[model samples]
Target: MRVHLGSDHAGLDLKNHLVSWLTEHGYEPVDHGPFVFDALDDYPVFCLRAARGVATDRAAGLDSLGVVVGGSGNGEQMAANKVEGIRCALVWSEATAKLAREHNDAQVVSVGGRMHTLAEMTHFVELFLAEPFSGDERHLRRIGMLGDYERTHELPALPESAVGLGPDA
Candidate 1:
């Protein structure tokens, strides 16, 4: 599988480490980087590129995923999520990593560079890459709804149960 990676100065070291590790583990890692870091660099620039790479590849039926990292990963995750057809999840634990893939069918994972040890973060990435989407009916339904909304700026219909619960209720 091909994994696309992007990061700002805060995540440079970890991103480099992951590239080597990912290659050694038999996965191809594409670095969409700030090959040379500037402390003032923005996360969105690189992260959006990485996210787009993954989204385009997946749409072509290729097996691909993405990772975006930053000081707290919040901005990186937000940037990635802006890409159409991309499900980017901010992962902080083994469970979150697994759930990101299994439940949300996330194709990209964002991690906080300052949050965990290198080994711990690597393990989270490993789990995320190893797990497969559940393909359950509910999961698929939710994903479909998101895709629909992305394509059509239309909000999903409210549930019948909530229809009567206005200020008057």
Candidate 2:
């Protein structure tokens, strides 16, 4: 698998560590990075490129995924999601990592450099890389709804059970 990585100054160390770890695990790691840390560096500049790398590789039928890192990972996740056809999830734990891949079919995962120890974040990345999407009917249907909305800008029709359940109700 090809794993694309990006990060700001706050996450430069972790991102660098992941590159080495990913290669050691037999995965190709592409670094879309600052290479040298600059305190004022922006996460979006690198995260978007990492996300696009995954999107492009997937479009070409290659097995690829991405990781974006920052102080809190929130901005990086948002930046990644701005790319068309990219599903980027902010993952904070083992369960979130697994669910990001299995349930959401996320191609990119965002990690908070300041939120956890290096070991913990590394474990989360490992779990994310190891999991596969479930492809269950319900999951697929929900993914389809989001994709439809992305392409058409049309809201999905409410389910029968949700039709009348609003704030006014």
Instruction: Give the candidate number with the greatest lDDT.
Output: 2
Model 2: number of clashes? Answer: 0
Every candidate's CA RMSD: 1.5, 1.3
Candidate 2 weakest ten by summed lDDT: 160-169
What are the per-residue Cα lDDT tens digits for candidate 2 across 62-141?
Answer: 99999999999999999999999999999998999999999999999999999999999999999999999999999999
Per-residue lDDT over 67-114 for candidate 1, one digit per residue giving the tens place of the 0 to 100 score:
999988999999999999999999999999999999999999999999
lDDT on C-alpha atoms for all candidate structures: 0.95, 0.95
TM-score of 1: 0.96
Off by over 4 Å in 1: 167-169
TM-scores for all candidates: the values are 0.96, 0.97
How big is the positional error of residue 128 in model 2, measured in Å on the Cα after superposition?
0.1
